[model samples]
Target: MVYYVAHRLFSAHDRALGARVAEHLAAEAGADAVFLPFCDTDEEDLVADVKGLRLYQLDTRRLGGLTGMIALLHGPSLDDGVCMEVGYAAALGVPVTILTTDFQTYDRAGRVPAWQFPDPLIEAVAHTVVRGSTLGPRTAAANRFAAFADRNESQIDAAVCHGVDALLHAPAPVRPAPKEQRGVYIEASPYTPDSGLLAAARSSGRPAHVSRRFTAGDPLGAAVEDWNLAAASCALVADVSGPETPPGAAILIGAAAARRQRVIAYQPRPAYTHAPGREPNWRNLMIQYASDLHATTLSDVTAGLES
Candidate 1:
């Protein structure tokens, strides 16, 4: 009966087309489709609007240009606040719709646009959404509302089975807590930005440390340090989606796999890539990747924890 919409924001500078689309969607759904307010907005003004619907604010200003590189070299993490809202959505089991067609395009590695999270913390916890632009153009405003209602009803049913309440919803993992030990290793690669995955390993109750600092010039050196850290670790969490294709955050999953350590490789969808000759048909590829990853639904990460 209730629906939430998450998006970039409403801005005075934005063209009328975007506003028309938002109005159309809000009217179509009948359910309050709240626009995620931008971080630049005054919180006092936002207090009333933020109440009924979930509110999200991301400081994309930091990502204005080449700052990710500079942050990689200097800051503890390049994407510190970037994942905040998504992480919260995952935790609360809310569905998120990314409202942009520009984001749906695949990158060089055959992966969906890098900006969209294929999979992340609280895996099946949020509904990653992408609205169809066609729906708003010709249909009666009322027909659009009916369509929104239909689409959302289907999404909620799927959320029930996902790890929406895993911490409290599911039984605990079978592994014993790690002993308080020295020399912990962390995989802090700029390519794999979902550090929340590290929390799963840390939950084993050991003193684990991840390398939050990274630099491009010393990628090999950084990998070596991670390997050493894994060597010292009782188990290494890695992703095995391969390079060249560079499976975004999944690359860390692959690196951990290469280390021959305990790893829970998060494969968003068998691996979609944009290599020269190996590329799949665009529309078909997008459909497959989204379907396979259950991109619109949240699943439980705790279910994969070793027993």
Candidate 2:
């Protein structure tokens, strides 16, 4: 069976862990082939494309053809790219197994409770979550990773294999295509009921669904509902005009793109910079590439409706 293994590839340590997982999946977990994004870069033309559009397309196309996906959920905060892949895979009805070996926790003495690892939205869409050793020092980075891997390698291998086997043997479900309705789903932070974009979509005679309207008061439930709305809509207009792209919006954008829906990302201005003379943060490459249109104004966002 072929599997797409998603993991952070920016560091040597990250790459090593990815390689180890891919190797175990192949040699021991009954996988015939494992696609590693970092190692599978054959798109010479898109190699230096700064916008990252072609590269994202290439990866998603490859991922859609895979049997399943295994994503590594490591680091203090989960990698954004990996989360996007998980969302995309989930939207396609592809089984996803999350492997997290990081032993970090965010619980505080007197603060609102927080998840020990991944956000609940991520867990909600995953088929399996294979958690590794939670018995390691919080610091001493390199040595800690080595020791953690040494202790949890066998455990992880067994869990991952079991999950893959179950998923492969499970009966496939029929996934109907989205209804041919020209409705627009708007994903925005601090959702406004009468936002100009929503108004514009309605004025254009397209039925519009605001993400906040689907809130279920529970994170997981809300995420699932919002995702469903995004899937059902013909287009998704995301307002990313903030310091950072909202995680939920990013996930929706990825899912929408995976379904080949029109994704219009609106970032009215450059992201806030902490100090003057410092470079301003831009929208993430994943969002830039996944979106069919990158709108810098409300009018640009509205123009997408006509297309």
Kindly list the per-residue Cα lDDT of model 1 for residues 150-253, writing each as its tens digit. Answer: 55444432332221222122332222233432433444334655646457545645566565323323333444444345445544333322231222233233
The per-candidate count of clashes, in order, stands at 19, 0
RMSD of each: 18.2, 5.9
- Count of clashes in candidate 1: 19
Assess the local accuracy of residue 105 in candidate 2 as a C-alpha lDDT between 0 and 100: 48
User: Estimated TM-score per prediction?
Assistant: 0.30, 0.73
Q: Which candidate has the highest lDDT of all? A: 2
Q: Once superposed on the true structure, which residue ranges of model 2 sit more than 4 Å away at CA?
A: 29-32, 42-51, 102-119, 136-177, 190-200, 213-215, 241-244, 271-284
Cα lDDT over the full model 1:
0.31
| TM-score, prediction 1 | 0.30
Q: After superposition, how far is residue 285 of candidate 2 from its true place, in Å?
A: 3.6
